[model samples]
Target chain A: MEGKIRQILKDHGRLSIDTTKLAVDSDLYQAGMTSHASVNVMLALEGVFDIEFPDRMLKRSVFESISAIQTAISELKTN
Target chain B: MTTEFSSKILYDDLVKFGHIIPVGVPGIFGRGAVFEEILNRFDAAVSRLAASDHATKVHFPPCINRQVLQKSMYIDSFPQLSGTVFSFTGNDAAHRELSSRLKDDKPWGDLQTMTDCCLTPAACYPVYPTFTGTLPPNGALVDVQNWVFRHEPSEEPTRMQAFRVHEYVRLGTTDVVVAWRDLWLQRGLKILLSLGLPVKAELASDPFFGRGGRMLAANQREQKLKFEVVCPVISSEKPTALCSFNYHQDKFGTIFNIKTSTGETADTACLGFGLERIVMALLKTHGMDPDSWPKPVREVLWA
Candidate 1:
């Protein structure tokens, strides 16, 4: 799941830095991922995981870092 | 002193005095002649105040190209507020069906297809597409006025669904853009102050949609990217934003391939004056009759 998330980030994150070197807890927005790019990332994640994010989970903290995204995906998958 | 009840009273008074004509729409209304005169005079006053800047003036239509709107990424942040154009492009048989549905009062929205253009969300949006290249040493400064549409409808007289904005856009290096925005923040306050309205300038954020949008809005506020000059036009507790100052740090430049003379992505800033809202503020402040307004305020606008 982590590897897949990284791949998705690399493909759609539009971050200024390489995802391979980014820490799991690093702030994606601080790394130059724009609000526009973040939406694409969310859509791609939903498509890959086959889980729809509820309105409550659609927040910045949920997508702030790779770890946060992983945790959100996990919660959705279990549900 | 202004409450929800007073707001309704104000709206009714404006309509009674023929300042605003209710066209049977909540947030849409036709302007009376006196209201139009005041609007035009206030618009000219703003232009006069910014005359020293000598910005290039441009007029844009109310709708922009759909592709440009998508590229600007407005839909991602404000899907709820965006308005897209739709039109009927069908054969004779389909037209007859559409006509029948319309005559029968059945839903006919499905018969229309989305057009290549959408209603312009902001007055400055169409300007970015025109700057898809490098700027001069001094960069670019534009003065634009156009009708902007947002989907929100309400009983608040100040919250119009369609309105005009007089906007000034500056595109250049980071320092230049930021400085321009900061300068305008002060100038905007002064412009409203000169009109004798109880105005205040404060940090603000766009009404981004959805749960994700709340985070984006908080981030925006934290960055202090937007500021609004607000006036108590309808409610004192919840003032209306008469003007806004926004600093877009290379967002449009990156999207539109705009560059500075130094080969760096250009930063952009804009200051917009809500024409109708300002007039509304003036009416609320000085009473509805323009001729009876204070001599100094009347001179500031009429002069």
Candidate 2:
């Protein structure tokens, strides 16, 4: 799940640094991912995981870090 | 906080004094002659302050191309606030059905089809498409004034559904755009001060919609990308934003394909003065009668 999240970030995050080198808890927004880029990342994650993020889960913290995104996707998958 | 009763009272007073004519809408109204005169004078004062900038003046209709709006991704962030133009593009039978529904006071919105245009949400929106090519070595500065629309219906007199914005747009490098926005924050505050407004500049964010929008707004604020000059128009506790300064860091440049003379994606910044809101602030601060306004304020506006 972590590897997949990193791959998705690389493909859509538009971050200044390599996603693989960054810590799972690192702030994606601080890594230079803009709000517009974050929207694209959310859409791409939804497509990859084949899951819909409910309105309650659509927040900055859910996509703030690799681990946060992994946890969000895991929760949705289990549900 | 401005209560509903207070909002209504202010609205009623403006109407009673012939400042705004209520057209039976919560946020839509017709400006009276006195209101128009004051609004125009304030707009002129702003223009005078920006005269040294020598921005290229351009005017656009209230509606913008639908495709441009879609590409700008406004709907993704502010779907609730967007207003799309719809028209009755039906055949004779459909038109008759629509007319019958309207005459019968039934729901008729289903008959209208979305057009290729949407109401302009911001005065600077139409200016981006015009700068799609490339900027000169010195970059580009543009002056535009247009009626912008938002879907939020409110009883607050300052929150108009349709209002005018005197906007200045700057497109250039990152440093240039950021500096211009910062400069305008002070300049806008100074202009309001000259009018005797008790205004203050503070970091602000757009009213993005929904849960995702909360994150967007936080990110925008964290980056210090937006600021506003606010004053107590209707509520002393909650001031109204009369002018906004925004720094769009290569967002418009990337979407509009705007390139700098140095061959990099251009950065963009814009400052918009809410003309109607300013006039409302003026009325609230100096009573309804302009003649009774402080002498210095009158001179700055009327002179």
* Candidate 2 ranges beyond 4 A from true positions: A10-32, A40-79, B1-5
Task: Give candidate 2's chain B TM-score.
Answer: 0.97
User: How many clashes (backbone atoms < 3 Å, residues ≥3 apart in a chain or on different chains) does model 2 have?
Assistant: 0
Q: Residue B120 of candidate 1: its Cα lDDT?
A: 94
TM, every model:
0.89, 0.88
DockQ for candidate 2, C-alpha atoms: 0.31
- Please report the candidate that would top TM-score against the real structure: 1
What is each predicted model's overall lDDT from 0 to 1?
0.89, 0.89
Tell me how far the alpha carbon of residue A37 in candidate 1 is from the true structure, in angstroms, after superposition. 2.6
- Residues B1-303 of candidate 1 have per-residue lDDT tens digits of 233436787898799889898888888999999999999999998899889999999998999999988988797778989999999999999999999999999999999999999999999999998999999999999999999999889888988899999999999999999988999899889878999998999999999886567666766776788999998877778889999999888899999999999899999999999999999889888887888889989989989
Clashes of 1: 0
lDDT of 2 at B172: 98
Residue B214 error for model 2, in Å? Answer: 0.5
Q: Candidate 2: give the clashing pairs.
A: none
Worst 10 residues of 2 chain B by lDDT: B1-10
Q: Give the per-residue lDDT of model 2 (tens digit) for B1-303.
A: 122325677788898999998888878999999999999999999999999999999999999999888999897788999999999989999999998998999999999999999999999998998988989998999999999999989878899899999999999999888888888898999989998899999999999886567767877787788999999877778999999999999889989999999999999999999999999888888888998999999999998
| DockQ value for model 1 | 0.27
